[model samples]
Target: TRKVRRNFVAEKYAVLIDALYGGRASQYIETQVSYEDGRTNKVAAELRIEDAETFPPGAVKQAA
Candidate 1:
């Protein structure tokens, strides 16, 4: 049997709860990520922070 690995982990990153204040949903995001190669990347994407509260119990939000 063979296995495949994914480079990006979908659940590893997210927006801070404080960022959403009485908002119905998230519209955009600004993030900075550093790879193991010592390179940093900036990206913008549509977000839905409404589920921030529903995240699993042990999920941790990393600092920017």
Candidate 2:
């Protein structure tokens, strides 16, 4: 008998909306996993923050 190992890569994207919840913030994130066997999986989540202002402006800007 032989054992096989699988390889996969994961990519993630996230965004934070300031003051979305009355002085708080909401962060949404999505992740995708791709496997060498042509299989794919996706996951998403949303988080609430109490002090989003602690982050500097343009800290999470998109790439050019």
Candidate 3:
């Protein structure tokens, strides 16, 4: 999180966002991320997605 990207949410966490509604077993993958100490490390994980409860349609109001 040191070498911060402007749009890191979409770049990094898009998978989790997509899988939030539907469950998935993602394949193992590696990514190079920077640290606060200016050091870089290889981050690896096999992400497991779990389904989440959602509100009923039209249950929540949209933000203006």
Candidate 3 residue lDDT tens string, 10-59: 77876666666455555455788999999999988887655568999999
lDDT of each: 0.61, 0.56, 0.72
Model 2 lDDT per residue over 1-64, tens place:
4554332111112133333435555666666788999999987787766643565786877879
What's the C-alpha lDDT at position 20 in model 2? Answer: 46
List ranges where model 2 is wrong by over 4 Å. Answer: 1-24, 35-38, 50-64
Q: What is the model-wide C-alpha lDDT for candidate 1?
A: 0.61
TM-score of each: 0.42, 0.31, 0.45
Ranking by TM-score: 3, 1, 2
| Tens-digit lDDT track of model 1 for 4-28 | 4343433333243434555646656
- The model with the greater lDDT, 1 or 3, is 3
> TM-score: which is higher, 1 or 3?
3
Candidate 3 clashes between residue pairs 3 or more apart in a chain or in different chains: none
Identify the superior model by lDDT, candidate 2 or candidate 3: 3
Q: Positional deviation of 35 in candidate 1, in angstroms?
A: 0.3
Candidate 3 root-mean-square deviation in Å = 7.7
| Candidate 3: Cα lDDT at 6 | 55
